[model samples]
Target: MHEMSIAEGILDVALDTLRQHDASVIHSVQLDLGLMSGVEPDSLLFCWEAVTKGTAAEGSRIEINTIPIEGKCLDCDKTFPVENYKFICPYCDSHFVQTIGGRELQVTSMDID
Candidate 1:
């Protein structure tokens, strides 16, 4: 699964940071994953733990902040929740809309020492 690669990449970055900062241990890693990011939190966590192995984050925790699917309707000029993969405007029932959020997959920060 892609979550495995994503988890590996995240761990690569975290491990590199730990080495650079001379961190003694990593307490946790927090991720800001959106509804449309297409990444599974459980799968990512599982992969994270599996890849950690003997690394500094071997026993670290992963906290996911799930963002809802929210977008702006271009036709209706209103903000509404988006369902599934359709980008329709809820108010005007138009299929054209601008997504404001809910497609994020970034590492905001982490707890380390």
Candidate 2:
């Protein structure tokens, strides 16, 4: 699955950062994952163990912070949380809504030795 590739890329970055900082061990890798990012957390977790096997990040914890989707309605100028991936404005019932957040998929931090 694509999650395996994503896990591989994450491990690559973590390994590169560890080398760049002269750190030999990684305690944990933290990620900011948004609801609309299209990356499945369960799949990523399942692939993480396989990808980190025998690597410097082996046995390291994988921490994911889930971000909720937030959007702003153009008609009413009201900002609200998006539910069920619906873009409809809650206050104005308008379809013209702009996404303000919940599209992120990035590594935020790492606990290293």
Candidate 3:
């Protein structure tokens, strides 16, 4: 799965950060994962467990904060949460909607020891 590559990328970043900070252990890694990021959390976690073996981040906890999809209707300027991949406006029933958020996939912080 592509999650293996994603996990490898995360581990690379984590290891780089650890080296930069001169840290020996990683307690946890926090991430902001959006619902529309197209990355499965379970698969990423499984890949992480495999990739981080014998490394500084081995056994480190992964904390993910899920971001819900939000959109703004262009016709009515109504902002609402999107459900089930539907981008229509809830108030005015407009199909012209622009995504405002929920496409993020970034590492926010890491707890080091």
The residue-by-residue lDDT of candidate 1 on 40-93, one tens digit each, is: 888999999898889888899989999888888877789987878688886788
Which candidate order results from sorting by TM-score in descending order? Answer: 3, 2, 1
lDDT of 2 by residue, 44-65 (tens): 9989989998999889988999
Clashing pairs for predicted structure model 3, backbone only: none
**Per-residue CA lDDT of candidate 3, range 8-103, in tens?**
888888989999999999888999999998999998888889999999999998889999999999999989999998999999999999998889
lDDT of 1: 0.86
Ordered from best to worst lDDT, the candidate numbers read 2, 3, 1
What TM-score does prediction 2 earn?
Answer: 0.91
Worst 10 residues of 3 by lDDT: 6-15
The numbered model that scores best in lDDT is 2
Considering TM-score, which of the candidate structures 1 and 2 is the better prediction for this target?
2
TM-score of each: 0.85, 0.91, 0.92
- Quickly count the clashes in candidate 3: 0
Off by over 4 Å in 2: none
Candidate 1 clashing pairs, residues 3+ apart or interchain = none
